[model samples]
Target: MLYKTKGIALSYIRYRESSIIVRVYTEAFGLQSYIVNGVRSAKNKTNRIALFQPLTLLDMVVYHRDDRDLHRLSEVKTPYPFQHIPFEVAKSSLALFVTELLSRTLKEEVGNPHLFRFLLTSIVYLEEATEQYENFHLAFLLQLASYLGFGPENAQEFEDQLRERSLPFLADDAMTDALNTFMSQPIGTPVRLTRAQRADLLDALVAYYRIHFDNLGDVKSLAVLREVLG
Candidate 1:
């Protein structure tokens, strides 16, 4: 069956000579893999390789079958082209890191319109962000956890527990408040945190996620993001 939906590119791998296997998280179908034929062919101008870039949003029409591992797409285009993420080094790295995290965090191969909307809005915001964004990924991760059904609703309690147990930076009141504020606020909301503080809170959140989700291993982008955003 053919279906029209909005999709956000998560990741893709080169397939054969001129083709690529791309995973797009769609509004109609959650995580769909499509083998885009000739997307990488330098001689072909019709098919776009940029459409498969990490966190690029697209409108797509796809062919689906029951319980199939791979799918086909009939049409795909970016309705809104990113203005900054493509050119800005920090934002580009952030997008790559976020999409990689999403690929691991979101496992279900079914429709999640709410989760999809949250991610779509987040990517747009990240692209347009002009203020402090060193902490943006941390905020995004916490909000995404809510969508994944294991949000840190009362991080203050956990902070106190960590302090009592003498768990590294959690013993610091400043770090504890930073984590609590990040857990409770929306993605765009600003919180006053230093570079070191932001890094600490993010490290804690990443540890928490690893404990909850078995598949979320070491995020390679963390080192680069910290070096750049620091």
Candidate 2:
């Protein structure tokens, strides 16, 4: 079956030095992998490799066959260019972190239009925000928790329960309040947090994930993201 869908590029691995197996999350097809041939060669002219960039938004035509593990692509192109995240060090690291997280976590091959829209919007938010982006990954993760079935929307109550449970990684009162604001506020809301506060809140969010999910394992990009954002 041929399907035209909006896709977010997740990751790709080189094959035979010229081709790549690219994983993309599509609006109409959930997570899918397509084998893109000969794009990495020096003599290539079609510029197919550009569409495989991490977190790039693309309009794609893919051949989907349930019997096959790898699919083929007939068309792929960027709908628009990112304004800044692709160039900024801190933002790019965060993008890589979340992209890896999604690649590891989103395993099913089923369509979800709402989840697809949220992912697209979040990517745009990362690109368009001019300031206060130091906490973008933390905030994004918390919002993602909601979609994953355990959002801390009732911030104060959730914090109180965590504290009562003696969760050692729980944030202090002021940071907890800031997190509450983060949970309650919409994306693009101005947020200010000290480096230490950001780290604390990020730890709290990771702890939240550890409790709710299985195998979210180490976010290796985190150390680099903290060093650069700080």
Candidate 3:
């Protein structure tokens, strides 16, 4: 059967001399792999390979077979053109980290419209915002935790008292209020998070993901992401 859907490029692996296998998360199909033939060949190489870049949002028509492990793409185009995500270093790094995390964590063939929408919105927000890249990544991790069913229940888990007191950056009442709101509605970005708070939250999120996802081994890109954000 042939199907049309919007997909987010997750990761790709080189196959043979001129072929590649790309994993993508789609709105209609949760996770799917497509094999592109002659991607490195002289004919249409640039256009064919450009659609598979990390975190690229694509509208595609694919030929799916019930018994086949790999599918084929008949047509592809960018569904939402990014303004700054690919060009900006911080935003690009964040996108890469998030895509890697999702590519590993989401392991189902079933459709998830809500998760798809959340990711699309997040990518848009990351592209537009200038300040608060760390906050954005932290918020994304927290929000993802809820979807993955391991979000924290209290703010204390995401705080370091010694640093909090020493810096006097985040007010006690403000942190408390934000945590309360976050617990109530485990979606969307928090107002703001301090540098210490961001680190703590990232740790909490990674721990939460590990608790839920048995196969989420040591994330190789995590160190690179930390370096980018730090």
Candidate 4:
């Protein structure tokens, strides 16, 4: 069967001599793996490989087999043309880190429309955002936690901890308000978090995920991401 779907490229690896295996999170199917043959020797290598980039949003037509494990791509093209995400170093690095995180965490083949929209919007927000890059990844981490059912329940508790830690970044009223909204609302609402609030929220969320998802283990890229923010 042939299926056309919009997908986000999560990761890819070289396969055999000249082929590649790409993992993508599709809107219709939760997660899927596809094989692209002869990409290394393709005439338009640059354009062809660009579609497999980490977190690249693409529109693709794939040959789907119900009983088979590997799928084949018939055609692919970028769907949400990124203007700054693929070009800017900081933005691109964050994209890579987030894509890797999602590729590891999202293991189900069940359709999740809310998670799909959240990721799609987050990428666009990151591309257009002009705020300090320090908090972008943290905000994403927190939101992802909420989507995964681990978000914090009490803003006052989070705020008290921030106060005890003397985190100056939480002084912003808007940031506080966003954190409050997120803590108060049901999981999956779009709450705008401040850079500082985002950091604190992410710290709490990481702890929660670590407690819940044992396989998360230690995120090595976390140190690199922190270094990049610093």
Q: Name the best candidate (by TM-score).
A: 1
Model 1 TM-score on a 0 to 1 scale: 0.92
Off by over 4 Å in 4: 42-46, 156-178, 181-204
- lDDT of all predictions: 0.82, 0.81, 0.74, 0.72
- Residue pairs with colliding backbones in model 4 are none
Residue range 133-174, candidate 2, lDDT tens digits: 777787788777777677876667667646766776555667
Ranking by TM-score: 1, 2, 3, 4
TM-score of each: 0.92, 0.91, 0.83, 0.78
lDDT of 4 by residue, 127-223 (tens): 7777644455656665676777766555565555445655433435775666665555433446565444555555554555555576877766656
Which of the predicted structures, 2 or 3, would earn the higher lDDT when compared with the native?
A: 2
TM-score for candidate 2, please give it.
0.91
Q: Name the candidate, 2 or 4, with the larger TM-score value.
A: 2
lDDT (Cα, tens digit) per residue for candidate 1, span 138-212: 888878888998776666655543455455545366665666776777677777788877777767767767767
lDDT of 3 by residue, 128-230 (tens): 7777456566667767766666666666644443234342233376656666555555345446666565555456556656656779898877777777774
lDDT for position 59 in model 4: 91
Residue ranges of candidate 1 with Cα displaced over 4 Å: 157-171
